[model samples]
Target: MASSNVTSFSHSTFVLIGIPGLEAAHVWIAFPLCSIYIITLLGNATILFIIKTEPSLHAPMYIFLSILAVIDLLLSTSTMPKMLTLLWFDSTVISFNACLVQMFLIHSLSAIESTILLAMAFDRFVAICHPLRHASILTNPLTAKITLMAVIRGALFFVPLPLLIKRLPFCRKNILTHSYCVHQDVMKLACGDTTPNIVYGLMAILMVMGVDSLLIFLSYVLILRAVLKLASRERLKAFNTCVSHLCAVLIFYIPLIGLSVIHRFGNRLAPTAHIIMGNVYLFVPPVLNPIVYGAKTKQIRRRIVRIRTEQKGKITGIYKNKQMIKW
Candidate 1:
């Protein structure tokens, strides 16, 4: 199954037909994709801005949240622009190196985002389970170390993915099923035996996502046990602190799991459904995170509302002055 020209893989280009079997609908698909991208950018940016400027939000929880915002921004930007270009302008060709870079960024950023979620879950677990030691447990220095480790973990694990793909003989049709390049997605195009790639990729996922997911669940379980011991009112308040994080987690994982299951098992499913599911998990968290946080967290909501109110007041004041002007 070796490709005819192994060296050609280095110079080969791949075509990303936005959604297979739905080429005619690419123009219409642009609307929702663009909207999701716009909202993701605006929402994540606003969250980071507010977190950075609001002194009240300088705690460990908010610090982790800002890290999450950055991850969301990076993850969304890694593929959304190229995707929109493909969908709107019918620009489907991507050079091999460019595709490799995109694949690396998307995978690494995803790994980093997963680690951040685990960190956030840890933060909540500590705060709820051992309230008195929360500050000492999650210090700024420790948080910084966590962030650094997350970054390094993602980089170290995902660096090999691009290299692995680069070594493969991709002499097939060179058409990607989706708009982006992922290890599995790109591996499918290679003409050589892909057993090693598939094995390594699955192992990478198990190491990064599988372990992180297990730990996150363990954290929540401990948190639940702790919450149960609190007074009724305190229990509600404690759970309230977790609502936004919970929403963010669900938005990120539920669709993600669904998509993964469908991909692995639902070969006979409609292509449109497959495409939509793929896009949903990829696009939802970035768009919904800030909205969920702002709407659910009272302090964040108040700060965002105040900013809007101040802007409205300034606009109103300017309009009133225009009525008093002698033009």
Candidate 2:
């Protein structure tokens, strides 16, 4: 096995095919992808900025959101630049080490994002279910601990994946299906026995995503029970706080689960279908998370409106000054 593995090693570097079967349209696709990347960066940054400057928004929920914003920034940054490069400059060659690093960041950040969402759910649960003790329960130190745990859990779990891939020798199949590297995609290209990779990969997903999803569901179920007992008006008001989170959850998990299922079971689908789903999974959440939260949350919406109003007033005052000088 060792001799065969050594003899079959053919690729010292990996090539990322931006989108399989869409080589001709790479340039055209870059336009919208670039737009989305810009939106993701600006939106998440704005969220972080607002949450930081506004003391009124410094509660546990907003703190978790700010943490989430940071995660989204990292998550999108990991892939969008290289993807745009592949689309525009047509430079597809990536070193082995760089590919592993990208893979680690992408997968681990995703897992971290999932964990953050779970943390957000718990915040909601405390606020709505135990309104009296919300402040006491989700203290600053506890929140920090939760955030740290999420980061450490995500980082440690996926750290071994790239190592596992490093042991396998590629046999001339260096082209990746998407713009970024993923464990499953990279592992499939190896010529060596991948049972360990497959088993560990499944175990990691089940432990992180699987357990998180289940706990989030359980949290919401309890929240629903608590919410139903409130007066009609109070019930609406209470549930409104959860809307942004639910939207965030759906946008993040639906695409993620869809991508995974398609990869495992939808082998009959076109490469384009797989590629499109991959883009949606990676791109849509960052672009939409800030928008959803800013629009849906009353405080964020008010702050944004006030900022716009203040800026408009300043611009008008400047125009009046210019007119006075002309007169």
Candidate 3:
């Protein structure tokens, strides 16, 4: 029976443990998770809508932001709904193929987001470091090419992940740690050799995130060097432009680092800690990114306020017209 199980990858299924040792609290825990998902969807959608409709926002920075918004939408959507199902409906079963698909989406989207953030850093670097050539350097065609490259790079790098996992034989240890599938968690359950999966996954992460992070840091260092040459007032103004992106960088990387640390080094920690960190790593950025940009970005902030003001005026006009008709 065990040998048969080892041979049958097609018939294998995995069960997701939503939050280990907290099964009884799953329903109660779902309320906040659902709220976060809804907020992520709405917030990112609003960012995209504003950037799309507002002509003044048709620049390189906003363009990158819109791409980030789309990524956030896809990233959260990839994992949250299934997580909610596990929490609310107690539906824990996921097929091997489905699990692979989920893992691919989650990891690929993360790669893309990291690339986008790095691109945004470069955009800022060019803007601050070479203000005169900003427009020439980041033309529409170039921006489009950059966006396309980020997508293609992310997708192509992880294409091997699912294929590698597919080749692994499972020996019936098919339980997962999180609500959604991840390459690391799923790879652990396979009874076959996981050294290839481990080595490949690490290489992919280093190539995508590790390299991007180093470049982003280098870009900022150059940007700071350029900014320091300006007068104090000009330096302040230039630094202000990067505030939102800096906040975004912090929010994104902090949780991710925390989760990675917990996964690798904190095995003695409670499973709940691991689960909560994972959720925060996935959910917090989407929920907070829009809010950060909306508040710190002057153009987006003014547009949002103008929209609300116009909406209020229209509502008042309709109410007055109805009152007049009643009279």
Instruction: For residues 30-126, write the lDDT of model 1, one tens digit per residue.
Output: 8988888899889989989999999999998899889989988888898899998898888888898999999898888878888888999999999
Error of 3 at 118 (Å): 0.8
Q: Candidate 2 lDDT (Cα, whole model)?
A: 0.90
Report the C-alpha lDDT of model 3 over 128-205, residue by residue, as the tens digit: 998999999999999999999999999999989999999988775566778888888888878889999999998998
lDDT of each: 0.84, 0.90, 0.89
**Highest lDDT model number:** 2
List, residue by residue over 1-327, the lDDT tens digit for candidate 2. 012332343456677777766678989999999999999999999899899989999998999899889988998898899989888998787788988999999889989989999999999999999999999999999999999999999999999999999998777456777778899989989889999999999999999999999999999999999999999999999999999999999998999899999989988998888889999999999999999999998889898998899999999999999999999
lDDT (Cα, 0-100) at 89 in candidate 1: 87
Query: With candidate 3 superimposed using the best TM-score fit, by how many Å does residue 294's alpha carbon deviate from the native?
Result: 0.2
Model 1 TM-score relative to the real fold: 0.94
Where does candidate 2 have its weakest 10-residue lDDT segment? 1-10
Worst 10 residues of 3 by lDDT: 1-10
- Residue 164's C-alpha lDDT in candidate 2? 98
Off by over 4 Å in 3: 1-10
